[model samples]
Each structure stands twice: as structure tokens, then as C-alpha cells.
Target: MSGFLEIRRGRAPLIVAFPHTGTDMPADVEMRFVSGWLARKDADWWIDDLYRFARELDATCIRTRISRSVIDVNRDPWGRSLYPGQATTELCPTTTFDGEPLYTGDGPDNAEIDRRRATYFDPYHAAIGAELGRLRAVHHRVVLYDAHSIRSRIPRLFDGELPQFSVGTNDRAACSGALADRIGELCGRSGHSHVVDGRFRGGWTTRHYGRPDDGIHAVQMELAQRGYMDEPADPSPDNWPTPIHAAPAIAPVLSDILSTCIAFAKGKE
Candidate 1:
């Protein structure tokens, strides 16, 4: 696709969005990284593969092939800190989840951050915003699921390990009570451990666009990489890799969660 972002159409009221699954960067930008490859580690590798069966559910799937490290699409474009006091990645991060320096002497300055945001972030969100507007116009209500994943444990960011599913509705502010309840219930039935509005209370995209009062609902699912990938405690050049075969162990449950959300959106419509 010529556009940095890719949007696929489905008549369903649900949009399965992958906001952190890219690994591509412009050549000039790639050279800025400490070692090019480290920059790609933050991507939600192979997320589309997890939703390989999304089309079967008639979902409107939207994805990006650019790595989040290049420019986090989930973050606030204004550059305001999402967690305030707590540690979190920046609009242009200087380190990985483990706090490993991604750039050498200096990272992207304010100007570079703005440049990347203009080149990729804004365009990506524009597509997301347009698609959500389209979906809601058609259904009168639309559900946006911001999909993401991270290694199970990252001491620099959080203590211990992350749960398999960390569902965030911005403390229930970004979506309807009905939407959250239905998705949470489905997660329980699917037998996968989950926490609602816990460590991750949603990101900028979820909080900014999920205007249920205006008939738009948004949710974010932060999956522990262990759930679907061969994650490592400390990543290296080769030892750890992603794209683990999707097994029935977690597949049916994920489908149930997504299916329930889809049905919930249609119900609202």
C-alpha cells in the first residue's frame, strides 16, 4: 500500500485495529537508531497473524506495517505524557521496554519528533479517524478495538509480569458500560485470564476517539507477548522470535471476546 496505513472494509460495526504491528522505517530514519534492529523490537510483531481469521467474522480490519518505535500511533500527538508520573514511552522513544538505549549520543529532538509525527502518526490516525467515522455513520455506533502486545515482563516499565490480557477502557470513560461488561464477560468465558481497566487504562487513541456519548466506543487490549509469542526476558539479536502458531488454547477465547464485542456494537446500532 502506498499509504503507511492499510484499512480493509467490512460491513460489521466492529473494527479490529492493530496500532503497533509495523516494522518498517524510512532509510534515513532507520539510520538514526543505535543499531537499526533494536528499534524494531518494540513492534507488535505479527499481530495481523493473530487476527488472521478476523475476516471470517466480517470485521473491518485496519493495520499498519510501521513499527511503533518509529512513531507510536497509540500515543497522544500533542506529546503529553499519558501516565504523567509513571514511566512510559515517548512520542519518539529513546529506549526500549527494558530501558536499553535505542539511540547513541542523542535521540530524536523535538523537531525530529514533530517531523515523524507529521510523516506517519498523523496520517495513520487520519485513516483511523476516517474509518471510525465511516463505520459509525453507517451503524450509528462503532466499536474500535486497539490491539497491542508487549513482552510479559519489563522491570523498567512495570513490576513482575503482565497479565495475558490487559483490557483498558480508560477507567470506563472511553466506552459504554455495556460494551465493557460484554467484552469482559466474554473474556472470562473464553478462559483467558484478563483484567479490565487495570495497569493499562487505555491510550491516547482509546481515550480521544471513544466517545460513546457521541455513539463511538473504543477499547484497548494489551496482551502479554507470552500469550502468543516466544517471548524472552532479555531480547538479543537471535534467541527470541515471534509468530508462534495460534493454538486452540487461546484462539477460541480471543474469537469469543472479539465476537462478543462485534455483536455488542451491532446491538448498539
Candidate 2:
């Protein structure tokens, strides 16, 4: 266990990847940021807690403690845009989702970016790959559920209000259609707004690891923060996060979605 990564092993053939729930920014790294809170504003806030029940299902949980502001593990390390011609952050983001500059001076140089990749990014993916190998050896198939969450409304990122659930399998190339459909169906049954392969069609983690032919399926679930937390129209330090509480109305639905993922991995669904 390194200072930046954490892995909880489970006996099931499912691994939940939490790449952006971290808030830690190394002291030297923080000194370069414009605002500490803004650097973390776009994080998948409390998603780890939101999916705390993953352990009960015996699903392995792999997470990073280093803030995404330092290095986004979900992005392509080669610097290819995930969404071509669209506005998005890079592997080492220079700005927040809102387009605010994160660094006081020029952002990370090429050397610094390389260092971050070696120190933080590489290990995170290594852990995921290692876990996948371990699980695939024991189970006929394995599922990689990349968990994430964002504000309900980010005009800079998407138009108007976003759906409560944004499911992505890299446009159906990352996982089997059956698995994707079942998860979408469960979300629909929850009566929450949802879209498959919508604005967020997975990320580097999903696209890089998912290989249906290899018996490894990957899917990304991007949840709207409003679905689980109190998101004020205008956020302030006092009420910005609103704490991490299980939204009485949404917890059961999320559980059902995760349960479906485990079932898919076990081929019981």
C-alpha cells in the first residue's frame, strides 16, 4: 500500500475502480495550485463512501488517495484526447472542469508529468491490472466497474442538466452488450434519468482494460452528484460539499446497479 493508492481485496470477480475520489494533494504540489478547494471541486466527491457497500458483495475496491489535480489516472497517458474536438482535461490537467486555471504559474512541465506518471498513475493502473489477473485466474469472467460522480450541471462540460446516471462502455466496445444493457435496465427501473454511451463514454481505464474477448469486461458509471448529495445552485465553503450522506432515495438504486454488475461477472444475470 503506497501513500497514493489503496487496494481492498475481495473474493468476488468484480473490481470497483475509484480513480477520482481522492482529495490529497502533496504539499509541494499544493503550493503550485491556485486554490486548493477549486482544484478538488470537480472530484468525484465521496464516491468511495457512496459505494461503501461494494465490500459487502465481496467486490475488490481499488482507489487512489492522490488528488486528480495532480494527475488524472483515467486519462490517456499518451496525451490523446478521449473526446476529440471536445473540451476535456488531460492526463495531467491544467484547469478545473469549470475552466479555471489550477496552477499559479505554468502547470506541470513534461518532466513533472513524467514523474507523476511514474509515481502515481503507473501504480494505480498496475494495481488494477494485477487484481484483474488475479480474479480472472479464479473466475471464468471478471467485471471492472469504474465509479465516478460529478455535479448535476456543468455548463462548460455538458449542456444544461446532466442525467442522474451516465453509463459508458466505450460505445459498447469495452464490455458485452448484455452486461451494459442489464446495468442500464436496472438504472432505468430506479426511475432516475440515465443515458448509455452519452456525454461520458467511459475513459482510459475502461477502454484500456476492457477486453470482452479476453473475459474482462469494463464499464464506467458516472453519477450526477445531485442524485446522492445536496448540491446548491451556487456553492460556498460552508455548504459546498454538504457532506457525504446516502441519499435515502438513491442508495437502494445504486446498490441494485452494483448488484447487477456482480451478477454479470458471475454470469448469473
Candidate 3:
């Protein structure tokens, strides 16, 4: 229970991980950024709020308070690109999704990057592993839902507008194909465009922790921000993030997605 980590224990065989919802940046870290807003722009904006209902399902929820700009907990610790030859942020990113530099001058050196990993990244994943171990002890099978969201259009990262729901199971290696199909089916019924194993086929968190044969099923849900937020073509402070209440139309879909995960964990899917 470090200052950077938040965990809610539950008896259910489900763990909902919020890896990028954090916006906090230590003063020293924030000082190096070009702008406060830009540093926080690419965060999984309001994702924690979008999935706030996870608590009601008696699902274990773990999140981080430190911004991903400091160190991306979802990235590979050893510096291997999740998508080789593709543009993606590093474990300790120095730029925004739009290719804007986040630092004033020089970014953290290799030594500093290692320190950030030890200080922040390690504990966050530790908490996740701890929660999973605790739940797997009681349940015959457990599900790890690595929740995330992004702007619908990031030309630097993808071709065009992303699907409303981008579900990933590391190409059926992270979890059972049945679980992924069930979730994709629900997304299709929600009337929202979706793709399985699309551009974001899950990040390091999904790849590292997922071991379906060991009874630990991991899946990553990368939602397009437009599905739940008022995404202006050019977002500024005034209109960048629409309030959570404004996304009522999509709440039922998110709720159904999570419920489906729980049902799958309990072998009811």
C-alpha cells in the first residue's frame, strides 16, 4: 500500500487493473514537463471514473496514482517494444501521443529511468500480482481485466478512428479464446464498433501476467475515448474531458462488459 498504489480487495475471481488513469506527477517530475496539460493529455482520461462501478461487482480493483509520463507501468520493463517497428511510448516516455516533447530540455537518462522503474513501476505491478495471488488461492480460476482508453484518433499511432471497444487477449495467448469471443460478442451487441486484436493487442501487463493454462486469464480492454467522453477535435482545458455524467449513453455498455467478465470468471459465461 504505497502512496502511488490503490487497491480494493474483493472475494470474487476478478481483478480490474487501472494502469493509466493516474494524473499525478511529483513536483520534480512535473517541473521538467513542457506544459502541465500536455503531460497529462494522453492519460486514460477519466477511465477510473468510467469503470467506477467495478466495486459493486465485488471485483478487486488496483490502480496507480503516478502519471504514466513518469513511467509507463504497462510497458515492457526490459525496453522491448510491444509492437516492434511501431511508434509507441517508452517505459519512461519523453513525448506525448502527438509527438510533442514533454520535457523542457533533456529527459531522464538511463540511470534515472532505472531509478523510476524501481521507485514506481515495481510497486504498482507488485500490488497487482499480490491481489491476483490472493484471489487465485480461493477461486479455481481468476480473470485480470487490464482496463484502458485512448483518443479515437491518434494518427501518429494508428491509421484512423479506432473502434469503440478494442479488446485484446495477446492474440488468444493471454486468455482463453472463448473469453475473448464472449467479450467481443457483447461489444458487438452494444452497437459500438469494435475489433479484436486490433492495433492495441494488449500491452505488457496483459502479456506478462496472463497464463491461461495456469488458471489466470488476462485481457485488456482499450476503449475509444469518444465512446464515453466528449472528445472535441482539439481538446483544451475547457472542453478536453467531458464530465463522466455526460457519458450516460455508454454506461450500460461498459457495465455489461464488466459483468460479462465476472460471469466468465465464475464459469457462467
Candidate 4:
């Protein structure tokens, strides 16, 4: 088992990835942070629990245990902005989403960034690529569902409260048109606010590995944190990550989404 990542193997033609759910901050890295709370504030909180049901579909799951504060596994290793011209975090962010500084000093320099990338970034993608290869070997098609979540309101990054479900296919270039449409339809019927190919149209993982022609269909599901948990207008260390509802409001819709993903990979949708 790689200490950096956790991988659960399955035979199904589906892979569920949780890139921002990690909160592990190595001692050396933690020392540079302004505070542990700010360092972990932007993490996709409780995402591991939110999507735990993916295990039931026998979907291969890959999750990084290293906090995004150390290195964002879903980001481009070369430091290219996923959402160009928009305010977003970096491969190794030095600030919180609210634009608060996270580092005591000048944060990670180029040398430190490179070191973190080699230590954390590479292995995460290797695991993902390895899983994709394994699944593709057994099945003609495989679906990589990159799961994530964020607070509903972050004006610095977005204009208004984000939709309950932000489904992204990198402008439909990552996955099949039919698959995108299916997810849109389900979200539309779920009675929750949702948008497709909006502000967030997937990330480096989706765009890099999503080769439909190669039998790999990738999609990113960015759920607004409000849908499943209470999102304070102004979050603090204590009240930020409210417990995920015993029964989240978006549970059934999420189930349908994953089920459809499996069906699409199996050519049943």
C-alpha cells in the first residue's frame, strides 16, 4: 500500500477518484503553514464519506491521503491553470480560497514545489493511470468519475452561490455526449440546481486522461457543499465542516449518477 494514496481494486469498468478529500499534512510541510486550519480550509471536506456508496458499485476507487495543502493531486504538475482567468488554487496553493495567506513566509518556492510534486503528485497519477490500465485491459470501455465538493459561496472564485451539482465534461470533450446528457438529465430531475460545462469544466485529470476514442470516458462531479452539509456564509475552523447529514439530501441523485456511469461504461446506457 502506498502511504500517499489508497486504491481499492474492482473488476467493474468504473473508477471513482477523490483528489481533494485528503487532509494529511506532513510535519515538515505543516511547519511552513500560517496555521493548520487555514491550510486545510479549502479541502473538499468529507468527500470520502459523501461518496462512500461508490464502493457498492464495485467501482475502483483511488484517493490521496496527502492534504491538498501539500500538493493538489488533481492539478496540472506543470502549474497550468485549469480555469484560466479565474481565481483558483494552484498545484501547491499558498492561500485559502478566501484569499487568505496560508504560509508564514513566502510559501513554497520553485525548489520546494518540485520536491513536493516528485514526492506526492507523481505517485497519485501513477496509481490512477495504473488503475485505468487495469480496468481498460478487462473491459473495452472505462469511466473515470472524478468526485469533488466545495463551499457554495466563494465570491473570489465564483460570482454567486454555486449550483448544487456542477457536472463537468471539459465542455463535453472528456466523455461521450450521451453520457454528459444522461448526467444532466438526472441532475435536472433531481430538483437540485445544476449546470453543465459551467465555471468548472473538469480539471487536469479529466482533460488529460479522458480519451473517449481510447475507450476511457472521464467526468468530474463538483457538488456544492451546501447540498449535503451546512455551509456557513463565513466559515471558521470549528463550524466549517459540519457533519455530513446522516442522510444527505443529494443521496439518491448521486446514486443514480454513479449507476448511470457504470451503465455507460458497460454500454448499457
Which number leads on TM-score? 4
Q: Which pairs of residues have clashing backbones in candidate 4?
A: none
Report how far residue 55 has shifted in candidate 2, in Å.
Answer: 0.4
Question: Which residue pairs in model 2 clash with each other?
Answer: none
Candidate 1 per-residue lDDT, tens place, 28-144, comes to: 777778876788877787667887777898888888787777788888898898898888998888888778888767888889888888888888888888888888888877888
What root-mean-square deviation over C-alphas does model 3 reach? 1.4
Model 4 Cα lDDT, one tens digit per residue, 1-269: 14878899988899999999988888988988998888888889888888888899898999998889898888899999988889998899988888999889888889989999998899889989999999898898999999999999899999988999999899989999999999999999999999999989999999999999999999999999988888887899778778888889898899899999999989899
Local lDDT at 219 for model 4: 96
Q: Give me the displacement of residue 170 in model 1, in angstroms.
A: 0.4
Clashing pairs in 1: 22-65, 22-66, 22-67
Could you tell me which 10 consecutive residues in candidate 1 have the lowest summed lDDT? 240-249
Q: Which runs in model 2 stand beyond 4 Å of their true positions?
A: none
lDDT-better candidate, 3 vs 4: 4
Task: Name every residue pair that clashes in candidate 3.
Answer: none
lDDT of 2 at 19: 99
C-alpha lDDT score of every prediction, in listed order: 0.82, 0.91, 0.89, 0.91
For model 1, the superposed segments whose C-alpha errors exceed 4 Å read 246-248
- Lowest summed lDDT window (length 10), candidate 2: 241-250
Candidate 3 per-residue lDDT, tens place, 1-269, comes to: 14988899988898999999898888888999998888888999888888888999899999998899989999999889999999999899999998889999999999989999999999989998899999988887899999999999989999989999999899999999999998999899988899999898999999999999999999999988887777889877677766655655677887887888888888898
